[model samples]
Target chain A: MATQQTQLLARTLLTPAVALLFIWMIVPLALTIYFATLHYNLLDPGSESFVGLENFRYFLTDPAFLASLQNTLVLVGSVLAITILLGVPLALLLDQQVVGLSIVRLMVIAPFFVMPTVSALVWKNLLMHPVSGLFAWIAHLFGLPAIDWFNDAPLFSVILIISWQWLPFATLILLTALQSLDEEQKEAAEMDGASALSAFIYITLPHLARPITVVILIETIFLLTVFAEIFVTTGGGPGLQTTNIAFLIYSQALIQYDVGSASAGGLVAVVLANIVAFFLVRIVGRNLEA
Target chain B: MARMVTTRHKVISTVAAWLVGFLIFFPILWMVLASFKTELEAFAIPPSFLFFHWTTENYVTVQERSDYLHHALNSIIIAGGSTLIAMLIAIPAAWSMAFSPTKRTKDVLLWMLSTKMMPPVGVLVPIYLIYRNLGLLDTRTGLVFILCLGNLPIVIWMLFTYFKEIPKDILEAARMDGATIGRELIYVLTPMAVPGLASTLLLNLILAWNEAFWTLNLSTLEAAPLTVFIASYSSPEGLFWAKLSAASTLAIAPILVLGWFSQRQLVRGLTFGAVK
Candidate 1:
């Protein structure tokens, strides 16, 4: 009796949000599918024609479409790898009982809260400018030529900036996980004459598995759809070198005025994201309980 | 020999820690410094750390170049308004799930989280159409509604974790005192959960403030916030380093101050569910 009542109450409480999101999901998707089969362009609004799967066929075969899919994967993968590698070491340092550690923590987390566009702009202009940026300044200081980060290396530059911002999140979570490690266990390990490196390998690394997974999953979801960095840094280019899937879709709809193709592309991106999200759901669901 | 090695290890770790911390913070520090430089001095080779001529000309130029105050105000309104709205709805919902949860409550929570995992671009087309059709494009109201709805799940999750620790018997006692549901929520639950709520609010406000995607995509002139304001420095011709820094410094200043003041609460809030 209690179980049934709670289920009903749960449904009642969750219904509003679930229903709203369901509509939010279904309505766009329905339009995209409907539009995909019909000829629709923002430029040619009055002319409507049923064209089944032609948009998808066009999008799939488009060279830019293929480049965008590859770009999205590269961006997400590189950011994930860099954040974990940098973040784990950073987390270990922040976990130390150093003086002024509190201030250090705040400084570390400051970047994560900077608006993405702002960060990208800062990186592009102040840091990465070939002639005038601090990077240019530094290379001159060392008597070397400056490299144009956005022009020559737009994708890597985006990856680097995004990882820099997200590094703190992974670090903070890992720091929390590190702090929760039992002092007694560490003391026993020390007493047994285990080296610090070995102790981390045997004990601390295992403890951090969950947080590491959480960081990767959460960051992946955000990174796959990263827009502002490219939007600000290179506008996804020195000619599509940095255009990820999200940027590709935005450019199609807003810049190219191809609503049908963009909708078809959006649906494809959604399906790919769902496949990634299905795994994320399993990982996140195992931990969250009321 | 062992003691000497330990001392060396300590020194090495301290140096490494400070070096990494400084690197992580260098971009922001560079922006602040660049904000005070003249455009020519800002571009100087061998980067004048302190020897360059100092001027607030860039800041002045930035202020005169754009509507600084208006973008700042738009940012404050959208971030503060969305966070406030999210909190107001989430608190009650989180309370119900935490204290009076039914068998399906966990499933509901999981489902909410799953929505967050879906790529935002997936729904962009339809939402654009919705906003366009409803005349909500480039409006603060539109931005506020989307942000609140977008972040509701996170707000609820954070509050639910905090609310779980409160004894159910306390609310029961308030009920015995003939306090109404609203009174119990406002006076009883709100007070008891103050730390949790305050931290949640602050974090959400920061997150909302920094959200760039939807704000940029949906907004132009009248509704565009600081993110767009900063992005404007990025031109198709090339970037202006000094001016961009000026805009970035202006954009991040308020949130950095908020973050400095609320460090402890932010730390505690971030660590709440993860540590457990």
Candidate 2:
């Protein structure tokens, strides 16, 4: 009887959080879906007529949409590739018995904590600036011409900044996974006259598969909505070269005040993200059980 | 098992690892170095690594130009307020779920996690309109509310994971000893859950401090945090590299220290316990 009473009390305690999250998730999302089908402009208040699928048609067919969509894919894909590729070797390197290991680990993980705006500006002005940046100084020393990073390659520059921020996360996760590798299995493989390359390929690579997937999925979710870096450095410009979908919708709703189309675009982004989220939730859900 | 590695191998790995670490950390190191230099010296060719005459003028100038303290206070209130509020609601929820999990507990937990996966942009339009109508835009309260909601799932998840690690036998023992629910919670659970709560607080505070997207979009001046404060230097009128660096340094230094301390919890919290 006492246990039954406590269970009811537990349900009561859980109500506030559950209720708030329910409203937070449902209300605005329903509003977004509703607004996506209407001709709503924030600037012209009191003029929101139902427009059916017209807003979606316009947003999906716009050339800028295609460009931003491509930019989103390229940015997410390139950053994931760079982080994971570099993260593997770096994690392996860090896993080795090295002097001052904690200090080195701190250095590697420092960039992940720097806020996006600061990192973007620091990279833009101090490091990637054309004439006076560190890259220019390095090029001059090597008798090479300085590359104007933003002007010549805006998306690539954004990728580099973002990659720098996320590389630490990948390294830390992979390093943790690496440390958990069964040493006995590796020793057994080594005693069987397996080469170092073969041992790593056979043993270490397999062990890393799960973590690498987790890294890829988590990074993709954040990478899909990388806004602050673009907002600070490129401003989605030099002719929309750096505009991803997140910035694209931002420009639509805030800059252009086209709420109808922006909401439509937002729904599209949500759909795209849900595809990735489905897999991520499954992976995490399975882990929750164990 | 300790494999015998040659001294040369160890030396090579050490050198290579340190070199990579330095290269990765160079941008931040360069920013900190430039913050102490003059405008001209900051952009000097060959980019002085450390030999420049160091000064605190840029820090003073940045403060004078923009009221750094006001924005810093806003950051403190927003991050700190939202975290405390979320913890208040999340603790009871997570505690109950952790201790008295029902048949639907996993489903509820997964549902909460799913809310986090929804892109902020998906609901940006509605939230903006709602905020505008409610007169919450550019207000610290508004930001705090949204941030708390935004991070509520994380706070709950983290606390739940931590709470699960606490053996249930103690709580049951307390109950058997004629302890009331309130007394059990106050004297027993709270003390035992302190470390986990502290880490959760630390990780969430760092997250709230560095959240940039909503802060950038929703705030202009009144409730602008350090993120907005630093972003204002993007299109400078004159030579302001030193001041920019100084401002950027101030914005990130506190959170960076906090982040390093919570690096272990970060992986577990972020990955939803998948990696850990």
Best by DockQ: 2
* Interface RMSD for each predicted structure: 2.7, 1.0
DockQ of all predictions against the true structure, Cα-based: 0.51, 0.81
Residue-level lDDT of model 2, residues B1-276, one tens digit each, is 144456667888899999999999989989999999999999888778888999999999888889998999999999999999999999999999999999999999999998999999989999998998999899999999999999999999999999999999999999989999999999999998999899999999999999998899889999999999999999982388999999989989999899999999999889988898
lDDT of 2 by residue, A1-290 (tens): 99899899999999999999999999999999999999999889899899999999999999999999999999999999999999999999999988888989999999999999999999999988889999988998999999999999999999999999999999999999999899999989999999999999999999999999999999999999999999999899989899999999999999999999999999999998899999999999999899
Candidate 2 is scored at a TM of: 0.98
lDDT of 1 by residue, B1-276 (tens): 989987787777777777788889888898889878777777666677877788878788777878688989999999999999888777767877887887777787777776666677766777787899999999999999888888887788888888988888998898789886668789888788998888889888988899888998999889989998887777743435677778788889889878766655554444335445
Question: Cα miss at B117, model 1 (Å)?
Answer: 1.8
Query: A1-290 in candidate 1: lDDT tens per residue?
Result: 64466556645665665666566556767877787776777788888798889999998999999999999999999999999998998999888756567777778888887889878877877788788778887788788988888777888999999998898888877887788899999999999999999999999999999888877767777888999998877887878899999999999888887877888888888888877777767765666642
State which candidate has the highest lDDT: 2
Score every model by TM-score: 0.93, 0.98
Q: What is the C-alpha lDDT of each candidate?
A: 0.81, 0.94
Fraction of native contacts in model 2? 0.81
Quality of candidate 1 docking, DockQ: 0.51
Lowest lDDT 10-mer window, candidate 2 chain A? A95-104
